[model samples]
Target: MGKLKSYQKQFQTLLDKGIDNAEIRHKRMVTRPFDFAEKLEKEAKSYSFKSVRQAHNQYAKSLYSSLRTLNERANGYAADLIARIDKEAAAAGAKSGNSKQPAKKTSTRRSTTAKKTASSQSSRGTASTSTASA
Candidate 1:
């Protein structure tokens, strides 16, 4: 046994209300950052930037857009690869992902023979078991 942990009632109440870990962190991230306009202006000037914070804002938007574009490209590539694989598989005689190859006529005949043999063996087993038990 371990010592019982205690907490503030409000913390417990928040837990009971179904707030999760990421939700708490997301709430924190979404909250306003410190207003560092003066510092930002100085830093931007030191780095030979014009219109303080303008470059940063543009960079953020550009990066975000590029990331979305990359994701779309990736999605398109995946779709293309899947189509190629499907075409290759069809060329190799596989019908669908789930469907197995249709059995050859000769194989179907052999399978039926195997099933009949199994059934006969099972019947023999039952007969022998009954004779021994009797």
Candidate 2:
């Protein structure tokens, strides 16, 4: 938190807001765990333990997906900040005539899991986490 630039400050605020929203949403989603547990218990006994476990896993996945997305958004912002800082440092060095090396191209390659998570979240209509355009 040492002398953050304007954009970095904005990004930090966005990240904090997004994370807080995600946490609140998750809390709302899980406020009645006993209800969910009773609902599952009321289901047909034919539901094997494995099946119930799988169902629980799916529910957990949905519950945690928003948190994961928030983390990824923060990581993306951090990466962008690093790139900006590197670019500014390079410009300063060039101005001082000490280094002639060009800044490395920023690769936009994304993680496969991130793409899948984003697409799945989009399909589920939950991609309004404001990863960009904050």
lDDT of 1 at 88: 89
Instruction: Tell me how far the alpha carbon of residue 57 in candidate 2 is from the true structure, in angstroms, after superposition.
Output: 2.6
Kindly report which residue stretches of model 2 are placed more than 4 angstroms away from their true locations once superposed.
1-55, 100-134
For residue 120, what is the lDDT in candidate 1?
74
Q: What is the C-alpha local distance difference test score of each model?
A: 0.72, 0.81
TM-score of each: 0.33, 0.33
- Candidate 2 lDDT tens digits, 79-103: 9999999999999998998966665
Candidate 1 local Cα displacement, residue 9, angstroms: 67
**Model 2 clashing residue pairs (backbone):** none
Clashes of each: 0, 0
Error of 2 at 86 (Å): 0.4
Error of 2 at 134 (Å): 60
> At residue 28, what lDDT does model 2 achieve?
91
